[model samples]
Target: MKISELFYSIQGEGKRAGMPSFFIRTNYCNLRCMFKSGNLCDTSYTSWHPDDDKNLGETSIESISDKYREFLCKDIVITGGEPTMYADELLLLCKKLKKVNKDSFITIETNGTFIGEFINYTDLISLSPKLKSSVPFDTPQKKMHDKSRINLKVLRKYNSLYKAGKLNIQWKFVFTSGEDIKEIKSLQSEIRFKNENVFLMPEGVSEKDLKKTRPETVKACLENNYNYTDRLHILIWGNKRGV
Candidate 1:
């Protein structure tokens, strides 16, 4: 499979926060998001630019397991430029990881577009759906028409996972503008899951960028009884990859 980078780090978000885990960040993303200033960017790696061919490296499942065994972590996180982009490979990889350590916990961070394919193998799933504000300003005219439709399909997949006894899934919406928050609330009404499983993550590549969205939003989530997730990797690495 095409992998961007892999390393051992604490899980910085979702239900497995602060756990010592191995992160496998795959390369390539299907979604190109527009930043607040109207710039187009890939949502794969938080720091990658849309125009840059930042394909770092690639490795097979055996190599991944070998590296993880050397690193000695009990948990593994499969993330990517949309990890679901390679569901078949990932399903096989997860099976290998499970055999390596039967008690190990496996989590997959996804953009929520391809849940149906990976549900059985995934132990924990973190679903982050792009909001309207995440649309790239310079999106090619050809791709714009399908982008909106795909986003809704992704949300429907997320709701389906929850209804299928997969409540361990966490819905994380990256909030940019206040309007993003409003949209997320509307999504909550649509999905109608328990508030505790919902999380609001500020859409930022660094701690400073995240703070620009304001701590008040976290307070707002608390006031309204939703979970707030801080991107610990961003806070510590400042948009750096392979943490």
Candidate 2:
């Protein structure tokens, strides 16, 4: 299988924040996000950019399992370039890891596009749906705004996973300039989930970008009674990957 990078790190986001964990970033993605422009996407030092050829690495399920066994961390994070882009291989890998450590917790950090195939194996699903302001509708080559963004099919799949109780799912909205927080609140209302399960993470790649979101955002979350998540990895490593 095509793997991007595998290493041990602390859980930087979501409910499992601060926990020591292992990260397995897979190669390829269903969506073509613009990373070079530094507009919407979070560019990692080790290259989390979906289309970067230099970031590509090769590994088998057995090797990955061996790495997990070596680290022996209870929490394992399977992240992307849309990790679910290769669901069959991931499922096999996760199953193998479970056999090695039955109590291991598996989390999938996804763009919420391909939940249909991976929901069963994942213990937690961090659903970070891209807001319009973050994803400009433009191709990387054209260097012009395109306005294209994540689809509703992805949203529905997340809802389905929540309803099925297959995994603990949380809605993470990445906010940037011109984003409509009220609209996101409305969407949350429509979904009918308690505010505790919804989170707002400032759209950022580095500590500087993360601090761009005013401290007041946390107050806004409290006023709205929603959860606030910080990008701990970025805070600690400043956009570095493979931590």
lDDT of each: 0.73, 0.71
Q: Which residues of candidate 1, in runs, are more than 4 Å off?
A: 37-56, 141-154
Top lDDT prediction, candidate number: 1
Q: Which ten residues in a row have the lowest lDDT in candidate 2?
A: 141-150
Give lDDT tens digits, candidate 2, residues 135-215.
434446233222324546667667766787755888777755333477676666566555788887776687776777736
Looking at model 2, the pairs that clash are: 136-147, 137-145, 137-146, 137-147, 137-148, 138-146
Tens-digit per-residue lDDT, 99-216, candidate 1: 8888878888877777555667667888877777776555473266236424566667667767887646887777666787677778777767668888887667767777876486
For model 2, the stretches where C-alpha displacement exceeds 4 angstroms are: 32-40, 44-56, 137-148
Task: Rate residue 122 of model 2 by lDDT.
Answer: 71
Error of 2 at 81 (Å): 1.3
